[model samples]
Target: MTQAFDIIIVGAGMVGAALATGLGQQGIRVGLIDKAVPADFDAHASPDIRVSALSAGSERYLQSLGAWPALVAMRATPYRRLAVWDETPHPLSRLLPGSLTEVEFNAAQLGADHLGHIVENSVTQNALWQTAQAQPDVTLMTGQGLTSLEQSPDCARVTLEDGTELSAQLIVGADGAMSQVRTLAGIGVTRDQYQQQAMVISVRYLGPPEDITWQGFFPSGPRAFLPLHGAGDQHPDETWGSLVWYDSPARLAELKALSDAQLMAEIGKSFPDRLPHLTHIDAKASFPIARQHAKHYFLNRVVLAGDAAHTINPLAGQGVNLGFQDAQCLQGLLKEARRSGDDLANPRWLGQYEQQRRPANRRMMLAMDLFYHLFSNQIPPVHLARNLGLGAARALPFARNRVARYAMGLDEQLPGPVQQILHRLPGLNRI
Candidate 1:
């Protein structure tokens, strides 16, 4: 069988689904394809090992798509405060108290209802799937993986593994970091894998749901906490949350081999004292970290979005937020293209999309690299400089808040000085 639409999106994950819903709502015909559908949300199940700290701007985008309410109903933890600090100890550290080096951003201080929400990846995918499926102009084809991609000067077409064919004026690849569509389209990526591997642990702690998420950086990497929902009646006094331990592959492998109880003990000893008393460990998984960017955002009649185009260091939980921003930009551009009666894959429009998104994505990748390199070392001068930097951020409220607003997605462009600093960083321009 064959299907045709204005656009066909491969990979119905959060970003792809969002794009489908947004475009469909605009009365554009869209075909959303995926290998398999996301599992339904199970309220009684343990929290998914994967979660995203969605920023305010992402929230607004979801609201516009009419998915935020469904996501909240399914389960989204709103955290009002976020904290980061240096956990590396040194002789010079004695000069600075913990308060001086620790930085925290509060919604109250920023006059916002909340900083952001901690949402499971599955929950987000499910909510977006429902919204996308509801769009009258959207056709969703699940359990259909892309097997071949062929693009002509006029349009693009993809063949699924089941022998089904779909064609469109333009094709979007949102299949993630290891994007098959990108590979088949002959798009290459420059990838640099970090030495650190992040192991995400889903655990239940003895407390109500927290309003804060925090990360304490060490020479090894970062030990962070993201709050989840309550543990339910099964454990009345407990709340679920996630812990992230970033370290070398060998160290993480050793940690993973330990029994749950042993891992819990290690976490209690190693994590910051601010971490609540963990009562149970529900899940643990680890993966290597990398910074990857596609050589081009588009070629011929095909384009890329989300992790397919770029994957940054996850130290700040900004990956999906960047993906959301990509969908928004591409959606707006496609709408403009449709109104102008231009080809959906017209270079004029895709070029603008690349011009607008590439720099912003590159800037974030550079920022993460700066932090990864700055904190993952023990040089006396560098160590002292980072702590002093944190202290300076605390001392300079206006500057600190401006940066915070940018991070929180409350502001669009970063402050001029910060962007200039990121742009000037050595070798960052190439990415």
Candidate 2:
């Protein structure tokens, strides 16, 4: 069978589905194909779970695409404050010298009142799917795996595993780390695996529904607390955020096997020196984490976006945020090219897309790696350096502001009104 659309997005995950919805609004026809439907129940359960943090940029873009409203009804929770610290043991040298040993971050010092919203993976996905289904030009094709791809001067020919064929001006690879579409387009990946794996477990908080996000880095990784609705000062039984607990795979397996009460006891061992509220909660599930990136985001008519393009460490929950930026840049690029009467499939334009995104992706990857290594190091010199670094960050307001803006997606060259408001929020004075 032969059919056609303006664009064919190979993976209909958050980033891909958002792009489809955005392009559809601009009167472009789209074909969104995914391997599986979002589950009928909570998508982020144990073993095979799904979850993502939606940055303000991402949330605004989704709202513009009419995808955020549906998720707001489900597991989406907002956080206005964030606290971060490195848990590396301070060397005796620092204590003798009267130097500070701890580094902390407060989100209010960032440009926004809230960092972003945390929503269950399927909550966001199903919302986009429901919105996408109503568009006459947006065709939803589930469980349709790519079988083959053929490239010509004008367009790419694509065949599904079910024996369906289509030709489109652009084919977008929004697939996960292992992107078949990127492979089919002859794209290469520049990847490095981290030594540790993050076992993200959902938790039922036994205490207050907190509005603040807390994270403390350890010799192993970071243990983060996300506030879900649970018993708080204002409301009782006000459950709140998911706890993203990072650990080595071997240790994670051992932790996963213990009874609920026993597992909670084991968790308490990590933070006995600090906050242990979240550690005492009941665990939902766990998974291994990896870092992956495509060498280039675009090649000819085929382009990679989201995790297909780059997957960073999740210590700070920036993976989906980066993917959102990719989607925006891509949608804007296509829109701008069309306005200039240039072919969207032109290699020159695709090259420009790669140029703009590759450096940014690389920077984030390195930043995460550095944080993971230096803070987790037990070596006395590196440990002292981390303490010094954290102390410097705490006192340097201008530097803190710059880092905060970068984290909030509000650099000197922000894109739209939504971002401008986020950057200009008065609460950032806390920096």
Which runs of model 1 end up more than 4 angstroms from their true locations? 97-100, 373-376, 381-411, 423-427
Query: What is the lDDT of every predicted structure here?
Result: 0.86, 0.68
- Pairs that collide, model 1: none
lDDT of 1 by residue, 1-431 (tens): 67889999999999999999999999999999999856888999999899999998899999999999999999999999988777777665677555544668888987989989999999999999999999999999998798899988887889998889989999999999999999999999998888899999999999899999988889899999999999999999999999999999999999999999999999989999989999999999998888899999999988999999999889888999999999999999999999999999999999999999998998778767655544444654333334435334333334444444455455666666555545544566667
Q: Summing lDDT over every window of 10 consecutive residues in candidate 1, give the lowest-scoring window.
A: 390-399
Candidate 2 local lDDT, 1-431, one digit each (tens): 68988889989888888888877777778999998866654433421245666777788888887877777865577877665555666554344322223334445776567777767677777888877776788999997688998878888888988889988999999988889998998988766666677766665544555666767767787887766544345334435456667878888888778887887666677643444255334446765666677766777788999999888878767788888778878888887777777877776667777888876776565445544443355666433334435333323233333343454344523223223233333222211
Choose the strongest candidate by lDDT: 1
Model 2 lDDT vs. the true structure? 0.68
